[model samples]
Target: MLLTLLWTLQGWVYLAVVFDLYSRRVVGWHMDRKMETSLISRALMMAINLRKPPPGLMHHSDRGSQYASNQYQAMLKQHDLVCSMSRKGNCWDNSSTERFFSSLKREWLTGNLYSTRESAIADVRAYIAYYNARRLHTTLGDMTPIEFEKIA
Candidate 1:
C-alpha cells in the first residue's frame, strides 16, 4: 500500500509497506518521494531479510503496477517466493494489509501532517515499533506481535 504525504517541500513522499499476515506485523517498509518499482522491491527485500522465510513462501498483493513490474517479479523469483495477486476489484483478498493501513492513518497519523519526509519516516518507524511490541491485537488473543511470536 502507498501512503502519500502532501505539502512537503519535495511535493510528495510515498511509503510502501509490507505487512505479515501471521502476526499482523509490518515486516518491511520504505518511503521515497517517488512511487517506483524499486520502492516495493526494497520493502520486500527488508521483509525477506527480516523473516528469511523458506522457499515457496507465498506473497500476495494487489495488482499494482509496481508489483507487476518485471523487476519486482524477478526479485520474487530470486527469493523463491510465489506471487499471488488479488482478483481485480476484490479488496477482501488483501484485508490484512488494508486494515493495517487504516489503523496507521487513524491511530498514528490522524489529523497530523509532517513537514519533512524525515519526520514522516520517524513517526512511522515509531508507530511500527509500538504496534509490534506494545499494542494488543484481538486477533492474537490480545497479545502483541512480538509476544505472540515468542509464545508460538
Candidate 2:
C-alpha cells in the first residue's frame, strides 16, 4: 500500500509499504518523490529478499495502476506469489495496511513539520523501528509485532 507525507519544504514524499497481515508487521518499505511502479517494486523486492517466502503465498493490494503495471506483475509472477486485488473503489479489502498507515500518520507524523525529505524519511524510519519493536497492538494480544512473530 502507499501513503504520502508532506514536508514543509520538500513537498510530498511517497511511501510504498508491504505489510504482513498476520503479524501486523511492515516487512518492506520504500520512499521517494514519485509514486511510480518502481517505488512499489523496490519495496516488494525488499520483502522478497528478507523473507524469501515460498511459492503460492497470497499478495494483496489495491487496484492501483502501479500495482497493475507490467513490471510489477512480472515481479510477482517471478516470485510465484498469487496476486489479489481489491474490488473497485473498495478500500476495506486492504484495511490492515490502511490502518497501519493511519497509525503512522496519526501517531508519528501528525504534529511534525519536516524541513527536508531526508528529515521526513529519517523520522519515518524511526517510527517503523519503534512500531515493529515496541508498539503494542490489541489485535496481536497486546504484543509488539516482533513479539508476536517470535511465538507464532
- Clashes found in each candidate (C-alpha, N, C closer than 3 A): 0, 0
- lDDT tens per residue, model 1, 20-104: 8888888898888888998888889899999998999999988989899999999999999999998999989888777777788
TM-score of 1: 0.93
lDDT for model 2, please: 0.89
The TM-scores, one per candidate, come to: 0.93, 0.96
Give candidate 2's total backbone clashes.
0
Off by over 4 Å in 2: none
- Per-residue CA lDDT of model 2 for 1-152, tens digit only, reads 55554555778889889999999999999999888999999999988997899999999988889999999999999999999999998878988888888899999999898899889989899999999999999999999999999999
Candidate 2 minimal-lDDT segment of 10 residues: 1-10
State each model's CA lDDT, in order: 0.83, 0.89
> Which residues of candidate 1, in runs, are more than 4 Å off?
1-10
Pick the lDDT winner. 2
